[model samples]
Target chain A: MRHHKALFKFAIKAGEIMLRNGAETYRVEDTIERILRTQDLEIVESFVTPTGIFATMDEEDGETVTVVKRVRKRTIHLHKVALINHLSRQFVEGSLTLEEASQTLQEIESRKPYPPAIMIMSIGLAASFFTVVFGGSLRDFCSSLLIGIFLALLQQGFYNSRVSRFLVDLLGGSLIAVFALLFVNTGLGAQLDKIIIGSIMPLVPGVAITNAVRDTIEGDLVSGISRGVEAFFIAVSIAAGVGIVLKIWFAVNGGYIV
Target chain B: MILPMALQIISAFFATIFFSVMFNISRKELLYCGLSGGLGWSIYLISNQLGGSIVVSTFLGALAVSFLSRYLAILRKQPVTIFLISGTIPLVPGAGMYQTMYALITQDIEQAATYGSQTLQMAGVIAIAMIIISSLPKSAPEQRKAH
Candidate 1:
């Protein structure tokens, strides 16, 4: 039992190290596998976080069980590590405070909303819904809000940033474009504000700013700025498409465009 | 959405906790960070409902977050970033940006500029709010240090 606790602590420590270094999700898993293999330990299941690790393992497996293991090779440039080493050279010098080191590792951790990120996404959704219902006319509010909420809650393959950032941006922009194209021309034109803002809020990079700052602090200014610019443009394009449609409507029929 | 709103609040509540855990913050210090955010945003929504301008409401909302975060850092203990980030989510200028673009596409250069300005205003509102909220606590001490 005592040995189990000790191994568990070591596993956790190993997790903390990976997380702090900014290992992406799969990278973190590989790191843990490396640690377990080094210790000649048995593994059950492993998972990664923006923070650290969660895993279940038992040494008793050494007594009788054999499990098939699968491996894949992934290449990563430990940007965060080189960053920390460079920054530490400027200020404190020598070793990093465990916190700094851990954060650096977590920086390497690939992008995903830790569960709270999802909640933030959801709450922002709720807030958007509430904003429309309370502020705008009910009919315009509902249709636009429904579109916004659906886009947010859909959680389709659009969530994959690497595969679909541009695609999702295009789709989101086009969807809003189509909605505005169809409705803004009609007698009951909707609240453009409600439709555009509420729908696109889920994808904004408030988190990216926080991460970018961490990166800048750790000395990866180029990468940090690039990510920030990329995120900012995706947001801008989402707005641009919808804006174009609304502009056309205003030209055809002169009225206050909200 | 059913009970997901409440669940979201709960998730946000613990998300900060998870951040704290990873960042090496004390466990006891987490909930205040979440509360500070929720409270600030609630106030922003309430004031906006009462006919305050979005700009004014957002400023006050950010102030509310920063104030409590600063107070909690003194009375309790936690990073201001947690509450500030979470609180600012409600204020991010999403609507304004859309309106600006919508104005642009239809060739209403004037209105596009107008709403574009509004979007800029909104973005400015959040940007300043972010700077203020993040700096409010430090400003106090920095002032005294200069004196």
Candidate 2:
């Protein structure tokens, strides 16, 4: 009974790490069930959604243990997801002891994301390269590079705040538009639309949209719908942010700036 | 035209690499992510130049990315999402979404409707492509069958 309880803790902890780091719902459930089944539990079932995990392990001759882990925070850190995936597979394959697995999970959980400077530079370069992809010229690329860096700085500033993610995106969209407009109006950039589009790419909900579809297709209706709504709201917020700024600009300039 | 397409593909490669960095994908897998992105964008460009509709081209691009991600998931022994998320970044209709919002803000309702539907279609097709690829049988399902 004690061993079963420890195993349950390990499995749920692994699932929690995966969930909090943005693994898909199905994957988390699979990992938890796999971990629990390593001990020959007669009935092991796990239910995961975008926000929480519920699992029960029933042994034929032993007590049944149920665990519920509520996951509230999420960010895109695929490396952590992949690491837990590897760790769970190892534990299932019998190569890793329970203690080792728990220790590794702790390490993975405590792992920090890439340094802020590198992330900022990457974000800036991503925006600039996307400008080129969208047929922007050298001048437009330069402006987007600056805008992307500024946007990254803004995001870093908000990284520790308790602000809502959608509001951050809304602010991000407005920031991109504001900078794009500033550059164009000042003759430092050409093609306002291209710059805004490129800079906004960083803030789009690609992960949420993809995961929502994947979850839905895998028959996790609850997770799918919730993630889909998340994607929709994010899209709407970004659009609203950009729309408000452009509307004000249009009204002030008496015409379309582009 | 070919030169421009090549430029777009190369930029996609680097852009995906940088995006992967933001996603905290490991350094070892960054190159593969970049390759997947470049491959997907190349397909998008070629199909678009071949007169495919934007939606159809996005579907093909996403299809290619999904297959590549599955393959790399096996080859590199990593989760498919690492590659899929970054690979599909370029095809996620950010431009279309922006265009739609632009039209709406400018009170061009007709154009807004057109772009908005196109954006949704592109997103839908990408999802369908991923589903098709993921649902395909794996090499050794007997292991999964054991459960």
Candidate 3:
């Protein structure tokens, strides 16, 4: 009974790491099942969602151990997912034991994300490059780079304030539009469209949209629909923020096509 | 023209690498992620220049990215999502969505509907392209041996 409990706990731990790292539902469930099966456990079943994991292991002597883990926050850290996948494979191959695998998982869970300053710089670079890819002029690229840096700092401020994700995105989009408009009016850039589009790339929900489609195809209907709605609202919020700023600009300019 | 096209591809590469860094992809896998993004963007640009509609270009671009990410995953022993998500960044319809919203804000109903539907169709086609690639069976020895 003690051994069964330990193995089950380990399986759930693996699932927890993957789920919290923004893995799809099917991948998490498969990892849990594979981990438990390698231990020679019979009748192992796992159900995973975007927010939780449920699994049960049944032994021949009528011993059953069920584990449930709720994952509250999900961030993109594919490295952790890949690391856990490698550890699970090693454990299944008989090289590592449960204790070592769990220890490694703990270490990964506690690992800090990249420093804020580096992340902000990366966002600025991405925005600048995206502007160039979208056919912005050199002037527009410089403007986007500067505005992107300011947007990152503003986002960090919102993050520290513990505001909801929706509000942050809304404000971020408005801020981008406002800055881009300011630059264009000051003769720093010629194209408002390109500048705004470039800065908005960092806020777009590319992952959510992809995962929503993939989840729906995988028949995880609940997760699929929820993610779809989340993506939809994010798009709406971005559009709304940009629309509000554009409207304000239009009114101020007396509807002139400047 | 050729120089501009090359610059665009290179910029796409750096943009994807930056996003990969933002997502915490390991440094070892960063180059592959950038390649995936650059290749996808170049394909989209070429197709668009060749008179392909936005929907067609986006679909082709996403299909290439998905297939490349799978192959890279086999070689690098990393999860497919590591490359897949970052690679798809360049092909997403950020500009189209913005144009649609701008049209609506300016009270141009016809333009709004046009851009809005174009964005929806492009999104749908990209999803279809991804589904098609993911459904294909992998016969590569490396992938077969990994399982």
User: Which structure among the candidates has the greatest TM-score?
Assistant: 2
Across residues B46-146, which tens digit of lDDT does each residue of candidate 3 receive? 99889998899999999999899888988898878888889999988898899899898889899999999998988888789878988887667655535
lDDT, candidate 3, at A178? 90
What level of docking quality does candidate 3 show?
medium
Q: Which of the two, 1 or 2, has more lDDT?
A: 2
What does the TM-score come to for chain B in model 2? 0.95
| CAPRI quality level assigned to candidate 1 from its DockQ score | incorrect
Candidate 2 chain B least-lDDT 10 residues: B138-147
Runs in model 3 lying further than 4 Å from the true structure: A59-63, A160-162, A256-258, B142-147
**Residue A52 lDDT (model 1):** 36
Each candidate's number of clashing pairs is 22, 0, 0
RMSD after CA superposition, every candidate: 12.8, 1.7, 1.8
Question: Candidates ranked by lDDT, best first?
Answer: 2, 3, 1
Candidate 2 residue lDDT tens string, A67-183 = 878888788889999999999988998999999999999999999999999999999999999998998889999999999999999999998899998999899989998999999
- In angstroms, give how far residue A57 of model 1 lies from its true place: 31
Model 3 residue A205 lDDT score: 85
Off by over 4 Å in 1: A1-130, A137-145, A153-155, A160-164, A177-192, A209-224, A244-258, B1-57, B70-79, B136-147
Two-chain DockQ for model 3 = 0.77
**Across residues B7-99, which tens digit of lDDT does each residue of candidate 2 receive?**
989999999999999999999999999999999999999999999999999999999999999888877888888999999999999899999
Better of 1 and 3 by lDDT: 3
